[model samples]
Target: MRPIGLLTAAALSFLTSVALAAEGKEGMPQLDFKNVLLKSQIVWLVIIFVVLYILLSRWALPKVGAVLEKRAATIAGDLDAARQAKGAADAAVAELTAKTREAHAGAQAEIAGAVDAAKAAAAAQTATLTARLDAQLAEAEGRINAARAAAMGALRQVASDTAGVVVSRLTGVAANAAAVDAAVGSALSARGLG
Candidate 1:
């Protein structure tokens, strides 16, 4: 397959060359350097080449260079701006993290202070309540002692009066000094107050 393709290409190339030669413009006018040397085709071709080179160097090359420099500068500026933006973002993140840490510390400190204050307040309240309860208990005890003393005195007086009445009835006589004395003595002895 490859050999056939190569043979076909060679045949086509040979045919194209023969056709071009048959149609060649061979009778064109020739420039004679002996009469007009500077106006020759070779001289004109050199002039055109020089003019194109001058125009490209003076106008086209500078414009192209300026455009490339401007593009390069714009690219560099964009990269620098991107770098600055990234740095700013990093700084902002650091600042935010620092602020968060500070806030956490402040909150923890405040919570600790509040807890301490609450504990102190509770302790003070507990002390006050204990003191108040103690005072109340003491007062209650004093009142109970006074009531018991009064009740005992009243019972003793009632017993003495009853004994006097009984003695008078058993003796079948009026109330006398001896009977009274005996009754008082008996009452005192019964109450262990003698």
Candidate 2:
């Protein structure tokens, strides 16, 4: 309750001071149209405003405008430079891409050529081996045939001698070589061995 009374007293004092201050002002000087000093003040305000305007237009404004124009031109030049750089980068990328494609194609062609060469070499080796094997086979067959002919000749002579010996032992007579050869020849032909 004491705090509330103190706050009321402070607010009343503030209000009293504001009222006294307000009562001391006869009126707003700027609104006093009949005062003679108001006209002189207006005249001085116009002269200062005109002087400030002239100074700004002739000196400060022109300098500021030149600075803004220079900044704009620099920005435009930087933008054009960036565009040119981008164009150069794009052209370089295109050139590099073309080179990469060409290199790829060249590598493919080389690979194809290598494959063809390998295939041809393999074919040639196979053909050469086949021909060599055939030649060896033919030679072996010829040797076998020669051995068979020699064995056949020796078997015929042995057969004739055995037959003559058998005939002598059984009949006490020597068989004629020509007659035995003819008999063996007839037997061999009948059995399909001749």
Candidate 3:
């Protein structure tokens, strides 16, 4: 017998002794030692306890243990899946970060290239404008010099005419055109006007 059977037997013996002591004295028929059915009741109680324990050990307890084991396995599987997902997520995040940095660098390079191109275009335009302006300025200077030369030639002719008119009026004789021109030329050369 198991420990539980020993205990049940000991309990049953003590109850029987008590019932015998209180047999004819106690008014409770349930405890009466003269009642032979009490022994059969004790035997039935022991049989019921043993059968119930066997049923629980063979069927119910094993089912409960299987359920617990399945639950533990499921929890472990879920944890492993979560860890794998976290690792994949971390790798994706790292890749995204690297791509982001690469895209930023590419954008920066493109921006710098655009800036350089713009600056070069502007410089070229400035040089072209400068050259055009210089040409225009030089043309203007040449026009001014031409106009001054023409004006000076007209002034020399007028001076010669005036000198011839003065010479004819003072000497009462017609002045020579060749002599007037030579005199004006000499005067103009001396004054640095020729």
Candidate 4:
């Protein structure tokens, strides 16, 4: 009961007790057998308690239980949905990670191929340059050999002319060109110059 209503009832009961005491009563009136309303009050209290019990059991309690059950079902469904979403997210992350690794491997392969190609190209270029240099060296050696041969021929002619001039000037006799040439050839052969 409300506090105000309980307090009012208490006050009324006190006033009744005080009135009874003023009338020379020996004990409380509600407990007294002389009170005529006591039986009726007990009957009404029983009827009201039974009615409240029947209402709570048949209608109000069941509605409250149904509301609680519905709330629990909703919470359980939400939890299941959350778990499914989390699992999907995890799977997507794993797929993404796999794809990333695959792409990285492909890139590495491409880089390795490019490096190999560059090395091959560099080797080919070096071989071509080496071959060209060898050819040029051979040509230079041939030219040097030809020039040396021409220089030897000119030096032999000059030596023979000088010997003939010396013999005619010193001995007063002209030397034969053929003999001078033969002598100079002999001298050069002995010195290992020819």
Candidate 5:
């Protein structure tokens, strides 16, 4: 048999022997221990059991429930705080990214503006330089025209004097030298200088 069964049989045998010894002689009454216990008072047992149930339900059970509720609330509050912190971190990251983008845009705008200003300044400088050069060229041309005109006038005066001398000598004509010189001087003076 199983160990539990063997142990139970031994316990039962010992109880039987004790019960038989506790009895009177064989002719006297054989007292039954089971029947004596059953006939004993039962009112006190019911009262004790009821009192223990009332105390556990009213005080002990409520206290245990309150402790469990407090633990649950603490865990939920911690989870909520974690979630809020995560949201705040995400918002901060987003803000930083936006600021970086804005800074890049601003830098690009500044670079473009500087380039435009440089181009405009270069164009303006070129215009100014070209105007100055054009004015110089025009002034130089005017001076050359004046000098050429003066030179041509002097050449004409010399040619006239030479022709007059040749004709007077060939024809044996006595031309007035003073009149010829005066005419040549007048021709030279008409151009702007004597």
Candidate 6:
């Protein structure tokens, strides 16, 4: 099949020349119905018009329509792709948000657990230290009591020796040991020291 565009271009050029010739011939010949060539010109006009219309409708117009349809389909495909991409991006963003929240929660849980463990360890250490200090205090108190007992025993011996010397010097005779010890014991008991 011949290209309709080329045929149409040729037809337009021929029609322009015919129109110019008709003007040169003093008037529009195609409109003059009384002329011998008027019938032939009208028949030729009808034939050209029908042929042009058929060529445009069957070949040229269908090709243009197909091109338009193809362009529309391409645009639709691009739009669909863009929408799908947007959906995927949205899903990815939501997933990332969820994961971030989960991770944050997990970290918080870990921190709480660590704090609890640290608190437990501190309590255990405190208990152990308190027990150790209490034991040391008891041992120190026992030592102090023992020292006090030893000092008191030594004080009694010293007092007895001093009493003997004082008695000999005052009476000019040796004091009896049993009588001196009895006097010291009575003196200590009266003073609430025995």
Number of the top-ranking candidate, with TM-score as the measure? 4
lDDT of 5 at 95: 100
TM-score, one value per model = 0.43, 0.47, 0.45, 0.50, 0.49, 0.47
- Per-model CA lDDT versus the true structure: 0.82, 0.90, 0.93, 0.92, 0.82, 0.89
- Candidate 3's residue-wise lDDT over 1-194, tens digit each? 69999999978977876786677445447657777798888999999999999999999999999999999999999999999999999999999999999999999999999999999999999999999999999999999999999999999999999999999999989999999999999999999998
Which residues of candidate 2, in runs, are more than 4 Å off? 1-97
* C-alpha-based local distance difference test score of model 4: 0.92
Model 5, position 170: C-alpha lDDT score: 88
TM-score, model 6 to reference = 0.47
Q: List the residue pairs that clash in candidate 6.
A: none
Model 1 C-alpha lDDT per residue in residues 1-194, reported as the tens digit of each score: 99999999978876876676689833213423455653676789999999999999999999999999999999999999999999999999999999999999999999999999999999999999999999999999999988877876776666667766776799876666566767776767787853
43-73: candidate 5 lDDT, tens digit per residue: 6667888998999999999999999999999
Model 2 Cα lDDT, one tens digit per residue, 1-194 = 99999999988977876786688954445667999999999999999999999999999999999999999999999999999999999999999999999999999999999999999999999999999999999999999988988887787788888888988899889888899888887887788766
User: Best to worst by lDDT, what's the order?
Assistant: 3, 4, 2, 6, 1, 5
Q: Which residue pairs in candidate 2 collide?
A: none
Kindly list the per-residue Cα lDDT of model 4 for residues 71-130, writing each as its tens digit. 999999999999999999999999999999999999999999999999999999999999
182, model 1: CA deviation in Å?
40
Separately for all candidates shown, the number of backbone clashes (residues 3 or more apart, or on different chains) is: 0, 0, 0, 0, 0, 0
Ranking by TM-score: 4, 5, 6, 2, 3, 1
Between prediction 3 and prediction 6, the one with superior lDDT is: 3
Candidate 5: segments with Cα more than 4 A from true spot: 1-57, 145-194
User: Which stretches of candidate 6 lie above 4 Å from their native place?
Assistant: 1-31, 124-194
